[model samples]
Target chain A: MRMDRLRELREAKGLSREGLARVAGVSAKTIEAHEYGRTSDVSVSIAYRIAAALELPLDDLFSASLKAVTLKEAV
Target chain B: MRMDRLRELREAKGLSREGLARVAGVSAKTIEAHEYGRTSDVSVSIAYRIAAALELPLDDLFSASLKAVTLKEAV
Candidate 1:
C-alpha cells in the first residue's frame, strides 16, 4: 500500500489479485487491501508468502516506507 | 527445524530461545520445537517473524533444504 507497487508486481507476473491470493494463502480482500493502500503495513509472513508466490525476495514485495516501519517494530 | 539453523541464528543474534520467541511473538515451545528439529518445515509467517527478530532476511533463518521445501509447498 502507499506505493508498495503490489498491483504492479502482480500485473508484471500476469496474476490477477485473486490468483495471487490463492497462491499466497490469503484472502483476495487482503490482496485488494494492500493494493488499494487500505492496509499499508504488511506482516513479514504475509509479505514472505506473497514474495514466494512471485518468486521474489520479501523486500521486493514491499515499499521502502512500509519496510522501514515493519522492520523497526517487533514481529 | 531440521537444519533450519534457527538455533545457530538465535545464538548469532545474541538471543536466547525465549528471548527470540518473545520478539517473534511466538511461544518458546515453538522455538524449542524448531531447534530440536521436531518441526521440519516453517510456515512463512513464522520464518519471517524469526528472521525479523534477528534483523535478518527470511532466507537467513532457513536452511537451504528447508527453504526448498517450504518454497515449493503452498503457503
Candidate 2:
C-alpha cells in the first residue's frame, strides 16, 4: 500500500532511495524502510522531510485514509 | 514547536486532551505526550487519525517545518 505509492512517487521524481534520502537529510535505510513499509509507524517529522524533498504535500505521499492500529487498540 | 500547535488546535476546538483522544481513538496519554512533545517521533498513522478527528489536515497539526532528530543524527 504505502510502499507501492512511495516507490511510485520516488521513481516518478527520478530518484533512487539513496537520492531521496540525501535530499530529505535522512538515512537511506530510513527511506528504504518507508518504501517497504518496514517500520510499524512513520514519524511525523520524517514524513515532513520526505514531503519537502519530494516537493509535495505530506498528505499526497500518505493519504488520509491510511488506517493505523493505535496503542489503545493494541492493548 | 509541534506540541504548542497541537495544544492550541485542540484547545481552540473546545477539546480536552482526553476528549481529543476519544475522538481520535487513541490513548489519552498519547494525545498528552504529543501536546507536550514528550515523544521523540510521532507515527504518521497516529497523526492521520488525530487529524481526522480534529477535522484538519495532518500538516496543520504538525507543520512541515517542525524538524526532528533523524536516526542518522541520533547515531
Candidate 3:
C-alpha cells in the first residue's frame, strides 16, 4: 500500500532507509524500494514492524475516513 | 507505517510477493519485509508504487480513522 505518511514520518524522525532497515531486520534495497513506491504487497507481520518503528498504531497506518451520515428521529 | 490492509488486499487479489514486486519494480525481499512488519520507513514514491500495484487509491493506503467529536446546540 501507499506510504506517503511513512516517508514523511521517517524523514521527520531523521531516520535513513538503512538505519530503519537495520532496526526492522529488512534490507536497504527493500526499504529503498518501499520508499520509492515500488511495491504494494505486504504481510501483516511487516506492517507491524513498520508501525513499531514509527511508534504508530497499526490502524493509523492503513485506515481511511468514513462516509458521513445523518439520522432523523421517527414519529 | 503499518500495512495490514495491504497484505489482506494483496492476498485477496491472489498475487504473490514476488509477482507484486515484479510489477512494482521492487525486490521480492522488500515485499516480504514489508509484509512481515520489518520496516516502517518508506518514501512517498514507493508508497505510490505499492498503491499502483494494488490498484488502490493513495489516500486509501495511508489514511486512518478520525477522532470522533459531538457538538451540542447553543441556546
TM-score of chain A of each: 0.78, 0.77, 0.68
Position B7, candidate 2: lDDT: 85
lDDT of 1 by residue, A25-70 (tens): 8789988987877864554445666878888876576566654565
Q: Compute the lDDT of residue B34 as modeled in candidate 2.
A: 74
Expressed as tens digits, the lDDT of each residue in A1-75 for candidate 3 is: 444355666777789887776665566776676568797545434544565566675434542421000001000
Task: Residues B1-75, candidate 2: write the lDDT tens digits.
Answer: 244378888989999988888888778998888777787666776777787788887778754345444323422
- Model 2 RMSD in Å is 4.1
- Could you give candidate 1's per-residue lDDT for residues B1-75 as a string of tens digits? 242588888898789988988888778988999788787555444555677788887667756675566546545
Better of 1 and 3 by DockQ: 1
User: Per-candidate interface C-alpha RMSD?
Assistant: 5.9, 5.4, 19.0
Superposed model 2: Cα runs more than 4 Å off: A1-4, A64-75, B1-3, B63-75
TM-score of 3: 0.42
**Clashes per candidate (backbone, < 3 Å):** 0, 0, 22
| lDDT (10s digit) by residue, model 2, range A1-49 | 1433677889999999989988887889988887777876666667777
